[model samples]
Target chain A: MFDTQSANFDVQGLSVALIQAELGRREGGIPIGSALISPLDPDVGTEEVPASGRIYIHGHGRNQRLQKSSAILHAEMDALEKAGRLAPEVYKKATMFTTLRFASYVHKCMCTGAILLYGIPRVVIGENTNFKGEEDLLRSRGVEVVVLDNQRCKELMREFIRYHPEEWDEDVGGSKETSARAS
Target chain B: MFDTQSANFDVQGLSVALIQAELGRREGGIPIGSALISPLDPDVGTEEVPASGRIYIHGHGRNQRLQKSSAILHAEMDALEKAGRLAPEVYKKATMFTTLRFASYVHKCMCTGAILLYGIPRVVIGENTNFKGEEDLLRSRGVEVVVLDNQRCKELMREFIRYHPEEWDEDVGGSKETSARAS
Candidate 1:
């Protein structure tokens, strides 16, 4: 449950591994960041048995921070509503939802920070205006999408090389040596 | 190296566990697809090597069949050039650059297939798109991102009864219940 949106997909048991791989790795033994939980989501109330058991969501920039905070408040209201812990009127009054767009500054800074720090490859997404900037940022560092296929096998193949460069070719065969060379 | 551009990146000293967790479990099985050494890439230049060490790249689709075929031929030529097995004119003539792109039909099909088969609780990204589609599909599955995030940490707190459902939770965390669960 590293990201709340992930839950709505068919995790097929991969979610746990994704979380472990991300959070367990450390540079200097410092945890990167804790996973954030979202309460506004519908699944939060389905299986509640404890006051402390909470869900988490993943976020990074200023927008992510805003999203995380929003999630927290949403969750609190959810918890209250589920437990019959809040007055109906109060819960109704608190039902306002705010949608926050990704902040430009934060996106630029964090995306740059990720590239600078890890040289890790990321899949860039945006409209025509931002696409070039994002693509340039990633491409300058030697990251770009080389294939998009209809088959799951092809997608998995691409992901394999992206995640495991050593076992595969860094570039020639989708391996990490390519990343090493680029870095 | 999942993508051609990754061949230029620097990814060294990263963990194998992290790679395995991210890419997919090994489970001691042969990979589904084969890897081949292609001559289209600039990396190959006539290095004497055993056939077993070489990788294969398949040409699955119709549109790019010729390019894919040519790429392999080009890689072989490059290998020869680097190894001093081929003449300089060959290098100048064969050095054709090719970048892979997924056709729109294929891209759409893949996204659609993932949704129909896996449902939500899964997020997919192509070289160009992230959070692409099927948000509504995920909503129907009751998978929500928040729940997935909660599931991410559920293992650490498995000692608590409520954190994991009796059926879905596993024995990664050592507990007295582990025995029964394993059984």
Candidate 2:
């Protein structure tokens, strides 16, 4: 009952509709599912998105136009996709819902951008200036955001593996961590 | 408009409802959003799952209990969570869906498992033995299934980076290749 697609990509700002438009132009693939996934902020990225992108978390259902998703931790996942760091199918899946890909707003790539991890370990945090005002919201939730450059994210993951080393084992599907552990 | 939770975790197979019950027990988190994120085979992982977990993809909307979601790609994210490789919120977020954690089903700790990737670059493919009979279905899609072990995935990825070195840039999030290349 929730698989909705939009023919109206003309809507302003980011949404499943707009991202679908973005995906089609960039990847030559079509988005699946049902939903009118639109951006809560009709004027997002106007004066808000810093040059890099924002990684914010929100209850997408808390918004009006989306009910199919509960969150979109937007980071640079799309940039990761464009850079060939991931598959188009994976990127396409992230666009099916609204709240989760909000993290995609902050980055250099326009067609697709970044994504973030809310409550995920090995967070690559930097200046909250990129996140608009969501940093304060995150702080209110008692999350500790820190510096996460390539080096820092690597260090953080090293710390993570120290606690969960099996995440490095191949059969366990630890490749995700193996790939992300910053080597 | 589709949300169903079950106190009946005793069903014969995997379903989003059973996974939700399992998540609450393991992580003390509740899944959000509408849809029944379950396995296609009611009797999965019985004899079909090899010593390792399976990585299969499908139209999640194909089931009746799942009306809001379109897919779930189970992999290894759960092992990371059980090992505390991730933060609680991210783990909690994952409980909102299913897939990647499926490897968790094959390993030491198993409360609930599986996850779905949004959109990333390299997709690690292997056999679909865990998927019951969907191997033929996926074959029809013209996707090639290969044997992926630690060494093979490493070799293939190395070959990939050699051809697409731009993916190796530190800022690009190809840290997997970054670390492995050194090894």
Candidate 3:
């Protein structure tokens, strides 16, 4: 939802979008139901497909057109093709709608950057690719990535244990007053 | 929009409707044509008002239900009120829509039990009387109002300065390497 391809880029002010979604069926979550998912590139001579499986990640440079990030966008396009969809006009409208909506949130985030440990924790897009490529690109851009490696994880735990302090201080004793009473 | 009156709280979530109206205008930054204002009570009654003069904030939280916080919920609510008035039923439905849609985000922030700060910047919420008592109550509850006075503001600026030391270090040396450059 947050990716902006060059075509929709603000010729004026730059902006970023952060897509947020929730899936649940309870008092505090969305009731399981249909979600309005838009097909990717609903241009003429395109097919329509269900937008519920797989994922997609798309990107565009400053001059590139229509940037998308997320496995979902691709799946939508695939769905359209598989379903032989013909709603090119509707798809185009949906694309613009999503872009504008996402851009608004992104603009808000970028304009008022939040304080974070290392540059605001952001979903950065270096090059749109598969999950692994995306992860690598983000890491290359100085983003921290946690990989599940048993040995490495164990080493980290060991190092942490080595540096653990022995001295412990809790408010157990009543301080000077308690010491005096004891004496 | 961050204000407090008595105990019952009036929390406002960001609204997509407002964003669409504000940015979807042909006038760009000019006043939108005939703003739709609605005065709706969650408890009872509904009235629609029109745009006049500068954008104004007008909404009720039923009884004394505004709470004091630096969060953007109230500001967003005020923005919606200024842009278009929603009938109580419509407002409630919209609120539900947002809550369900962004439940995960809300849950994550709420779970941390920490005050949240998020929304469009450069949006100034007018000084409100309803917030005074609520702020006092919040201080008593150990919530830190980070920018309460000049001294605190200065301290915060210094902290940011420290965090972005490389920006300052670009000239000579002194703690240059220790500070990472800002983008």
Candidate 4:
């Protein structure tokens, strides 16, 4: 059901590029983005981030446009913002996914957006790459994780770069967040 | 949005008795049960359960059933059955959830059905009572869980036994598996 290539060894990665390619839509300059977050994710909990918390590559969307499959992730972002670890404003209307790698520009942007918004220096997946419970385990230590498998985690950095032009340049307000926003 | 008691620290648990009290009905001596499982949990891979892996109380459902406000907790049952861990017949007509304790009876039955049908000997919550990721952590080992907070985990062994009358009596066709069929 996860639409995996090999369900045994794979999961579909919710990459930023994939979102950019699949969900990043512009209707008369009004961009419609979708986000998903787990309610249980520690990153979205309204608690303090343990000073030494782990990271996971995250892709976020607005709650207004968040997907049902992504509730936990949306919540994760909520937690990140509620806690002083992340700036509150940028994520106020966002949805997100946490993976181990910054697979694409959109992915990087989302992660960057988290860093900028959360004010955290970085996002890191926990110590074990394949440990699926890393998010839950980390969330316990105040570490949140959203496990990504190869099927869901295809590398799509180029697609993200190819599709998103407005936010690519800093001088032209090419900020990832700015470019992602449509009028 | 999660139907939690207080956005600060609570989620409502759905149990069978509660469901019996809330949604169950005796229609010609046959009880009507409806369950909704999420589509994105890691346990039910739609392939094979990794042997010697992990267990999480998976409450999987078809993604087609997922909504923006809910995460993947609903689909835990489908995964278990699909993996052949649970007999096909058991879940073909059933659905499931991933919360540790059922606030309602129907929720518990579906989850309990998943365990009994899957051939798992028992459902063990990890040692840590407050660990949220125990389901994900345990599901990785092939066991699925629904984390129970103090309010919901009110030792429902009696309630579980009471509602599941057919499965409780080891002497009178009380097998958890034998008692689930409704005629």
Highest-scoring model, lDDT: 4
Evaluated on chain B only, candidate 1 has a TM-score of: 0.16
Each prediction's whole-model lDDT (CA): 0.22, 0.24, 0.21, 0.28
In terms of docking quality, model 1 is incorrect
Q: State which candidate, 2 or 3, has the greater TM-score.
A: 2
**How far off is residue B13 in model 4, in Å?**
11
Local accuracy of candidate 4 as per-residue lDDT tens digits, A1-183? 222223431223344323432332322111222223221223443364423322322334421112322212222232332232222322332234433232111211222322222223222221122222212322332323344343322223223335545322221122344333321
- DockQ for model 3 equals 0.01
- For A1-183, candidate 2 gives per-residue lDDT tens digits of 122133322121134223432332233221211122222222243244322222222112111111211112112222222223222122222322322211222211111212212121111232222234221322343333233222322333344335544422221223344224322
Q: DockQ of all candidates, in order?
A: 0.01, 0.02, 0.01, 0.01
lDDT (10s digit) by residue, model 3, range B1-183: 222231311222112222322332222221111111122332233353322222222321100001221111222222332323222233322221011111112211110011111211111111212123222321333332221122322332245345544322221112233223211
Q: By TM-score, who's the top model here?
A: 2
The CA lDDT at B168 in model 1 is 15
lDDT (Cα, 0-100) at A178 in candidate 1: 35
Query: Which lDDT value does model 4 have at A31?
Result: 22
Proportion of native contacts kept per candidate: 0.00, 0.00, 0.00, 0.00
Worst 10 residues of 2 chain A by lDDT: A64-73
What TM-score does each prediction get for chain A alone? 0.23, 0.20, 0.16, 0.28
